[model samples]
Target: MTDTATTSSSGRRILFRVGWIVLLLLSALFAVNHIAGIWFIAASTDEQQLFEAFGVVNLLAIVLLVIPYRRREWWAWLTVWLTILPIALVVVFVPDAIGITYVVTAGVMSLGQLATLPSFRPTRTAN
Candidate 1:
């Protein structure tokens, strides 16, 4: 590759790493939010079942974040989208302070994935 192409490729790799970092941060934030939400809900309702359900969902979301971290592939994007879409929908329909927080944070997470999509292009190997 020419110098320009090499530079571009390096730049893309850097961007991809940054995107993954952002996604990781978002995952952490979501986990914290869900944990707190579960705690508050459990306290208010005395509902262990609800707590367990939300806890399981939160754990699953955090686990799924690892997929994109380990493999920058299209499916990773889909996974992240699947994780965020329900939160986004709740934000849209609920119209509460917490919902607004979800929308803003999830929106940033979505944008991070969008920015990273170009970097996920399959690298061409030499024949």
Candidate 2:
């Protein structure tokens, strides 16, 4: 409705919205993919454990990213940083996990969102 949310093709607002949507979708896909490894007793214990482990961490990262917190805070910063380790694990160990790429892409989006921090300037100057 306002200039910041305008949807014109050339508008920064539109581009930002598109970027966010892409990131959210990627995160969702990653969460669901990891959840796919269901553990029924006596049925592929190793695979199930692996999936649960990956899924829990991926889900936690996605959840943290969605919280309404400023990027500069410790928890918000931690969310971005903490996401890197498991992603690296997946990339190195499980090449078949298509969702790792998606999670990584979403992590990029989180970084981009954090980049917006500089735009929030206070009207008063500091001493």
Candidate 3:
């Protein structure tokens, strides 16, 4: 096995590790949303329907993202595209409800992308 080095430093490796951690954490939050949906559906609280529906959608996203998703998987990218499009719409139309959920989800996506960056780092040809 070879130790891959990019950008002439070890910081990229460290960041990559941190990025995975963040992705796992985000996955957990989506799991929570799934559970919360169960609770909301069982209760009679205000906006219970909305809570349940949102939970189901989030659970679908969690399931989609949880599977072994390589860059080669078209469905994986489709899942990501489905997730982001709604967030973008919400941010553009419902600006006031930019909640912690948005922050956490976006942060997770950002870190996950960053983690994969080093693996695809462009190679330079020596003259």
Which is the leading candidate under lDDT?
Answer: 1
lDDT of 2 by residue, 1-127 (tens): 4453343323444444554455455557766877865644326878788778767876776766566323324555445556545664555565665557745664675665554333323223335
Model 1 TM: 0.76
Ranking by lDDT: 1, 2, 3
Candidate 3 per-residue lDDT, tens place, 1-127, comes to 1244344436656664565456545656755764676674446664566555555665665565556333324556346556544434544544565554575466566657556455335545445
Candidate 1, after superposition: displacement of residue 102 in Å? 1.1
Which residue window of length 10 is worst by lDDT in model 1?
Answer: 46-55
Model 1: lDDT equals 0.70
lDDT of 1 by residue, 1-127 (tens): 8787798788888777777778777777666655776656556554545445545655666676676445766776777787667667767666999779878877887887776776768767566
Model 2 spans > 4 angstroms off: 1-20, 39-43, 70-74, 95-127
Error of 3 at 114 (Å): 4.3
lDDT of 3: 0.54
TM-score of model number 3 = 0.51
Model 3, runs deviating above 4 Å: 1-20, 34-46, 70-74, 97-104, 117-127
Task: Report, for all candidates in order, the number of backbone clashes.
Answer: 0, 0, 0
Estimate TM-scores for all models: 0.76, 0.54, 0.51
